[model samples]
Target: MTQSRRYWIPSVAFCAVLVTGGLAAWAETVYVQAKTAQLRSGKTSLDAVVGNVKYGDALDVIGRDGSWVEVKTAAGAKGWIFSNKTSSTKPSGTNDTLARLGHSMRGGDASATTASAGARGLDKASEGYADRTGVSARDRDAVDRMTAYQIADQEVEEFLREGGLGEYAK
Candidate 1:
């Protein structure tokens, strides 16, 4: 009786681990919106069509090979799809807003609003964020451009000091 119980416990534990691993491997999901989606297992053109996918269909994505996503189609056809071709549902306005702010900062158009104050605030914010993120190597150009605002602020301060505007404070 004792030997049978020991074997049964180990078998049940092994099956539980396999089942959990399998569930974790099948977590991603995707949807096909184009007329037909091309499924490829690899970068090679030899990746055969696991199946055809249709428009507005949901798929259970299993894994990825390079840039290709392995998915099971709504009709139960499993295959791979190019990552770039996947339709992303991000909000359009976010991109536009980021672009506008990026352009304004890059162009150094301070006169848009109290130019000096605006530039100082943006420059400080950018530097603070960059320091915190520490992965600013990808943001080098942006951080450099933002630093321009700090330079501009120092220039204004120097002009005021040399022009005797500093006497006004006394």
Candidate 2:
């Protein structure tokens, strides 16, 4: 090959490498829905709640896996979010609240866990009221909250159930 042609070929190859590498570094911003959302440092609430999130806001995509995405919001905030709850869904306020509840159930908040445990105990006491032919209203409320909290943890629960945790095990 001619000397000039050989130099041109290598230059083109170098440009291709640069373009591909740059694209790899390009971070994508995704929008959060207008609902309760939990952002955690890791896949579960056991990972600290990294940030409080709301709907219709953008967070930068840092990484992803099935059903989860690692995101960084403006101000350099970072966290993991359920992938399904983000972008192009109709009015998913319920899921958002569920996600937040998962955090509580997983001991994401120290104060919330204590309060929730107390509520659970109170709820069990209300079962005694059933003997009197009326539900203990307070206990019923506590049970309802507990049930909802478990449901909120369902995603992380399912992930663990399906051996997703194996990926993180060291």
Q: Please, what is the whole-model Cα lDDT of each candidate in the order they appear?
A: 0.60, 0.67
Identify the runs in model 1 with alpha carbons over 4 angstroms from their true place.
Answer: 1-26, 87-170
Query: Which residue pairs collide in model 2, if any?
Result: 32-56, 33-55, 34-55
Query: Which 10-residue span in candidate 2 carries the lowest summed lDDT?
Result: 108-117
How far off is residue 136 in model 1, in Å?
58
For model 2, residues 1-170, the per-residue Cα lDDT tens digits are: 59999899999999999999988567587778635577887885457777877777778888897767899877778889877657843345555988888976887333332344454443333444543667666766666677556545547656754774522332
TM-score of decoy 2: 0.39
Candidate 1 local lDDT, residue 34: 53
Candidate 1, 65-163: lDDT as tens digits:
765677776667667776654554422433487888897779864323233534433344554565687845557556455646444544764675566
- lDDT accuracy of residue 119 in candidate 1: 41
